[model samples]
Target: MSGWKEIILLEEKGISVDEFVSGFETPNKLILLEGCLDKWPTLKKLDRDYLVEVCGDNRFAVGPAQMTLTDYFVYSDQAQEERPLYLFDPKFANKRPDYRWIIIGPAGSGSSFHIDPNSTLAWNAVVKGSKKWVLFPPDVVPPGVYLSSNGAEVACPVSITEWFMNFYESTKTWKKKPIECVCKAGEVIFVPNGWWHLVINLEDSIAIRQNFVNRRNL
Candidate 1:
């Protein structure tokens, strides 16, 4: 561990666009910016009642199961069962053109450890609820994780809960901790190229996520 695996906070007020650009140039550092989306209207109207009134009728696949936004809200509102419903849809670019800007899902859901596709840098902005992010540097292979042929998927799939149950506690004894943060509403987390990360919704969360590539990381 060169330094503590912590994110650098860049406050939004008076922060120039060039400074934002410069921050991305340091590919090894994770950056968190607060108050960047304070004026975004979409962030304000993402609550359950609003989403149900707006998108309740539409049916979409939440993992292997299909359910409407109204049904999903009802399911998420109750206590979680042994197997939580995970709404990991990576095809918003194709299926839902109108809702392509952000990916929305309920609480008790999350993604396993994986890097963003195509060697791209990613920025995730939380709109409604909070998400807990567990990140490892690009060079550090997380414990209990094995890579596949192309190295995108893990050799054996593990849930965020399973990883926490089996591996998270063990990492505390290591020389460095994973880059961990709880991103609340109106904040953005910058994930650099090749970093492995697991993002879990700590609450019923709405987030807009995008990926980008630049000369330095390309």
Candidate 2:
């Protein structure tokens, strides 16, 4: 199964759930889970002024992000923002029922290609702008790994671009084949664990994403 790839390439057919579960590997598929978030209305929960007050506050990150929603709000770091946060156990501490959160901001806001702690499997669903995603294999992790900006303050540090992942190899020798794409509103992507990836909100986009523990991993 080898060929030239595109951003919105439909997933390979016949990828049975059992097969996907057993041999789902990194550098695998950037699946667009159709209608995954179709039930959730767009812009319904998104309010500009209300969110602006929460995001633009001087005490907060000076921008909008999941972390911003955590501090200085009804959200408690110990408590899950997702309804019935206790519905599911935490990935490590106590899987929270809600692994998903919204990302709404102007252009130029995106994330880097680094593995989340503990190799958690995750996904990104777009509700507004396009998202560019670049991924790398575990074997290709750069040697000079260090704090690119700072440790994850939940989401701020994660906001950094994939400079760390891209700062390797001579340009003349190896050009990185970033499997890039834009997840337009109404699309979702399942990002398997340990799959290094980076994303940029193409425009003033909004999306809700989450992580899940592979049934096999358990």
Candidate 3:
């Protein structure tokens, strides 16, 4: 028998994002980033017309800043402010910055499957339209999760997690049965740290979220 195989037995487990955060030992690096859409001013101000106007020439993405979706989104930046997120600077991250957000739609965004700043955990909440998501554990990425000329795949380092490499299900299957959620106007979610995710807009979506280290340091 294989020597390494004898030490561990793995199973495909279905877990809620909240449960995943609570059960793991690592400090959660990501959470459903939904703060703006939950409030009144953002909600009332975000509308179809407003989204179109904000997008302006930056139509790479746009949506009412108040619409919320508990889904995923793809990558787009028609009107991005040309900031550090595009550059990925670990120095600018908050001390407990485990989570981050994307404003999808006309004034917001159109983001795709990618890693968070510094290979940390990440999650998103759609404030407006439906969005799709995909994830792979740290190990699945052989060398590491880096954007290369090829695609999402890359030569990862040894520190990567085994779950990522061992996971056998195709993204298509996972997408078909992924943790489909809708954040509505006030709901929230918690995505564990180091998990990979992808998003696609279902409508002109609007939402906000933040990255925070789990308060308990699980």
The model with the greatest TM-score is 1
Question: Which residues of candidate 2, in runs, are more than 4 Å off?
Answer: 1-8, 11-29, 38-98, 142-176
Clashing pairs in 2: 88-95, 89-94, 89-95, 89-96, 90-94, 90-95, 90-96, 129-205
Estimate candidate 2's alpha-carbon lDDT, on a 0 to 1 scale: 0.49
- How high is the CA lDDT of each candidate model? 0.74, 0.49, 0.39
Residue-wise C-alpha lDDT for candidate 2, range 34-151, written one tens digit per residue: 5555566544555444554555443323133223332423332233221111111122122456465555445555655567556677767676657666565444543334433554
TM-score of each: 0.84, 0.56, 0.43
Estimate, for each residue in 1-218, the C-alpha lDDT of model 1 and write its tens digit.
32334666667885787776775545446888888998887778767688678778877567687778778767777847644676544454555333234555566687778887777888888888899888888887887789878865665357777889999988887776687888899999888888988888888787878777777767
- Candidate No. with top lDDT: 1
Q: How many residue pairs clash in model 2?
A: 8
Worst 10 residues of 2 by lDDT: 81-90
Error of 1 at 71 (Å): 1.8
Worst 10 residues of 3 by lDDT: 1-10
Residue 55 lDDT in candidate 3: 44
